[model samples]
Target chain A: MSNDNIIYPSVHSFSNLSLSDSSRTGFGYNPYKGPSSNAITPETSNILINKKTVSLTPTSFDSIYDRNILKKVPEISLSSFSFLFCEIVNWTRNNSKGIQDLEQRLNTLGYQIGQRFLELVKTRERIKYSKREIKILEILQFIHGAFWKSIFGKTANELEKSQDIENEYMIIDDIPLVSKFISVPKDYGNLSCSAFTAGIIEGALDSACFPATVTAHSVPKEGLPLRTVFLIKFDESLYTRENLRFN
Target chain B: MTLHSFYIFDRHCRCVYSREYTQGSDGGSTNRSNESDTAKLMFGMLYSLKNIASKLGDKEARNNLKSLSTGKFRLHLFETATGLRFVIVSDPAIDNLQSVLWELYSNYYVRNVAQNALSPVDFACDELLANPKFVSETDRFLSSLPVFR
Candidate 1:
């Protein structure tokens, strides 16, 4: 069982061929395309970019950013994240035309993060061999439990399906981390910073192939003034598919 | 103890990585399309097996199937939270296959492949296979396992 038996060619060989071609022509060559001419073998792994030599290596990128290298779950300071998030909200607020527009912008921003996170979280959970959540209820439980824990270090307080409507559901959180420091002025009128979180949920669900509309509502309780309820409204087609597949 | 092959499948049931060892056959004659067809069949079988296990298990228990054995070989499965499936086919006598799967996921797949920007999330990453460091490290890890001896 020697390594030689593995038939794949080295990526470095291709990289070397491109480097030689570029050096000989004294012009940048597209590495993706095959080498145009035989050229000098550069002494270093550096590549010329925009007329400046830039150091490059297979591992030049951050290894920590790699999901696998940091074996234990990574952590970021709450204070750091909070400050950064505050700046994002403030920036979004400054540019927004109105409250609705502000919320929409925040949602759009959160959506992309959510899409990437869905894959990241899913990749982390691959160890359990859990099947993809096909049922509406099952997927919600996943979001409320594993997904929530991954992001906030805690499970959601409650998950309730709306009794009046078949496709409506609610996930209640006592104090959403994103809005812990935010207080909406009276004029702001029902604005919840949790809207960002709602966008994240919406993005994750949308990418997972469960299209739904998610919105955050501020519903403060006696002691928990920052309480939030995320209302999820699934598309009618989701219900139709659920009925066809499960029933 | 003996290990035969390893496979990684993404959420979309696509084979993102596959490697065979100790099989003695070069498999050089097999084309890309044939390999893809084989992957599809394997994924379909695994999908059905998972669903069947879920339906047959007690409702309160975790539904994921861990491992199964036959007269010839055994199949070990480790599923990530995102629905990526890692399957290892090995000798029936092998022990602690789950740990091996964990090492492969955390050490090799996550570090060298997932973090690489050149490697796309949606397709099999041949660049990862071609990386000398990755291949060497994986070889070292697998060789250290008692089963490989």
Candidate 2:
């Protein structure tokens, strides 16, 4: 009561102000829309920014061969390289810690070489090689057709996907000829030169900028030839992004 | 002299044979038989060529061809790429010796040597000499030497 009687201008500045009328403009406003509808979703943001949107302009296969020039040296025997390769395998086996560890180490060794080989094979081919961002199917085809033919002197037996899993795919080779004469003793279960081949494929795919993981598995086919399967699996995110862009 | 066997100078070139026979009346059957005469003819023809090339410096290496008939061998000398010529003896005939000689020649041949030059042994040896273990051994050897004293 005593404060009220003092009536200070600083305390109560609106004491003398007169009331005024105001009107709201409803232009450009949707009254029925909820707050959630106006909010920017993560899904929408991803579509606008982070997705890899690329144009696939199909070019002819001639570009690959034009780049590969074969300069001939004197002929060398296959026997000349056999001992060297055998020692390389032996050396790798000696350094490996355990069986699985050895395989993993070998696989890692393969990864870099795979990258180099991809560039090499792309250039070396005379026909039906790819340069664009290739689909999984086309990559497997290129590996089966051109790459295998160049290295192993034949194509892979089968290219199939796992029935249960959408991302898993397999490249079945009837017999891995390099491992044909090789009998990896019980101690060196992890040692396999197939890792080298696996690395080659992985490198090629990575260089092409198609991200995928590849591993080699030995599956000896009965009566048929050259049996080994290289299982390739693409990351879920890779397929998802591809789906979103393509769809 | 009529020539029989000839040495190849290069991988592609052929043997030079002359039909001109020498006048040696040794009954064509004694030590101087038809085959022996032919071999002698080859030797005589090649020797002059070898001498000429040798005087020109070693342009091509000397390649010798040996011919064996009735366990007896004859020498035919010829210059290869180098002017140095070899007199081929019939002791170990050309066929058996050629392979060995070829392999030996190939090992030293510029290309094969170059191919193995970049191999791991060269790399490892260089690395080892640079390493402390090798350096320590070298130091010990040097310290124990009379030259150091």
* Leading candidate by lDDT: 1
Q: Candidate 1, clashing residue pairs?
A: A122-B82, A125-B80, A125-B81, A126-B79, A126-B80, A126-B81, A127-B79, A127-B80, A129-B79
lDDT of each: 0.72, 0.49
TM-score of each: 0.47, 0.43
lDDT (Cα, tens digit) per residue for candidate 1, span A1-247 = 3433222222322223332344332433433343443233462222222233232355745654464632677688876787677778778888999888888888888887888787778887887625877789888998999898888999999999999988899999998998775545456787778889998998888767678889999898999988999999988877877888888
Off by over 4 Å in 1: A1-70, B1-149
Q: With candidate 1 superimposed using the best TM-score fit, by how many Å does residue A226's alpha carbon deviate from the native?
A: 0.7
TM-score value, chain A, candidate 2: 0.63
lDDT of 1: 0.72
lDDT of 1 by residue, B67-107 (tens): 88889888899999878898887888875588888888887
User: How displaced is residue B94 in candidate 1, in Å?
Assistant: 78
